[model samples]
Target: MRWMQRTWIGSTITLALTMLFLTGCPKRPDVVETVPRPMAPQGEVGMPTPPPLPKVAIPEEKSPTEVAAQPSEAKPTTEAGAVPEAKIAEAEVKPEPSAEGKAAAEPELALKDIYFDYDQSAIREDSKKQLNENIEWLRKNLAGKVTIEGHCDERGSSEYNLALGERRARATRDYLTAAGIGADRISTISFGKERPFALGHDESAWKWNRRAHFTPSAK
Candidate 1:
């Protein structure tokens, strides 16, 4: 009986020691997870570039020579910018004449007469009507040109007579213009008692000298 109890106690003690050793032992480490790196592009090894900017329009400047090459806008004018309407009308339209009328109308100008003033003067009143008639005749006949030659009585100095003769001629020309004669066809010169129609030292000679003679220029 004593030997039997001793053997059972020994078996119980060994079982207890085995249980204690299993409770005190360390545990094993778990698995660690890892992520993979991204791969590079096939052709290029850098980042993508941005798109290029759009093109812009720029204006060009005109040179001075180019500006001058442009056409001008101003119009030309006649002499002194004065256009004579009556002269233009006369040139544009002409009147036909009969046979006798043509013979009479053929440009024939003559001084044919002498005008007189009181002694030592160049004033006349009736001469205006005659000068107007002569101018009208010249305009109607379409005479190409006419000249007025002025003279003075042999009483004043030669220079004074020449000046006075010019004054008379100018007065006659102005009257003719007022009577509707074209000034373009009429001209004036001064003889100043140099060319006398009558050969005498009397009133008749002075009368002839103090006149304005008309002469037609050959057409």
Candidate 2:
């Protein structure tokens, strides 16, 4: 009986030990190794890299000779072609008058001297006809001015002849004025008996001396 009790105690002890070992030592779970994913190539996910800028071709600078070689646009011209400067100057120049023009420009024949009666300042009929012809000439040549020279015979005293001569000249001027000639165009001068048409002291010379001469002004 003692042995049986001992064997039973031994079997119980061994079984209890085995159960404790199984419970205390649990089986380990499977271990998984973590690998870090390669970092995405720089700038793939967050901010993307900008593409490179395109290149622009620049033109080369041209030389002076190349620029000059280019054809220039023609200038616009008028319908009437441009006249030469010399030709324009020649056209502006006035041509000299011909010989015929010069001859035509010559002054007309002088008016005939008017004879006055002795000791009289009044104009005679014959003298009036001559004066009218002179007036016509003056009218045609408006630019001409005349001086009337009065003369007297040597019969009177020097002072008296001078007075007579002046009276004669005034009478001639008045006649010209009344005949429509401008007074400003006519001037008077008394020669008295100093200058005579004829040098002789006879009546023929005296008749010629008592005259009014018409002299055109040079100016």
Candidate 3:
């Protein structure tokens, strides 16, 4: 009976130790559930794909009509067939006259005027020489008619001066006619003291005012 009681006590102590160890020790944590990530589809797999092509561009085809319609570039030719640049420049340059041509341009005859003396009663002898030269020019030209315009010194009444001017003009016309100019080719007019060549009442002014002037008129 003692042995059995000892065995029973020992069993009871082991059972109590086991119960204590289980109560004091902590339990391990539970593992959480996880979902796997989806994978990317590969090109060689059951995926849709684009059509394959060559890397280089294909030459476009042209119709025969379009090719024939295009203009061709001009071909370079020799100087014999084409005008030279030097020739073109020469054409653009103007011709310069020779020295002989310039010398020949001098005038043969020139128009000249005559001056009279101060308030003279008649034309002076010096004026006769000038009138002779004028007659020579008239005979040479032979195309134009002449008119003698007589003027008086600004000293007398206008009406009296006008009559005096007319006499002077007629005298000049008679002289021209005697000098071999045709009477039909000459005419006369008179302007009195009312139209003075110079305004000052001086010798110099009177010389300019008392004059018979000649002007050529076309037929």
Predicted model with the maximum lDDT:
2
State the displacement of the C-alpha of residue 33, model 3, in Å, after optimal TM-score superposition.
Answer: 81
All candidates' TM-scores? 0.46, 0.51, 0.47
Q: Candidate 3: deviation at residue 147, Å? A: 0.9
Cα lDDT of model 2 overall?
A: 0.86
- Tell me which residue pairs clash in candidate 2: none
lDDT for 210 (candidate 1): 81
User: What lDDT does each candidate get?
Assistant: 0.71, 0.86, 0.73
Better of 1 and 2 by TM-score: 2
Question: What is the C-alpha lDDT profile of model 2 across 69-148, one tens digit per residue?
Answer: 99999987645878877788999997997765753465434455788888998999888888898888789889988888
In model 1, the Cα lDDT at residue 4 comes to 88
TM-score of the candidate numbered 2?
Answer: 0.51
Candidate maximizing TM-score: 2
Residues 118-146 of candidate 3 have per-residue lDDT tens digits of 44446667878877877876787677577
lDDT of 1 by residue, 176-210 (tens): 77777788887988888777777788886776778
Q: Which residue ranges in model 1 land beyond 4 Å of their true spot? A: 1-106, 109-123
The C-alpha stretches of model 3 lying farther than 4 A from their native spots are: 1-121
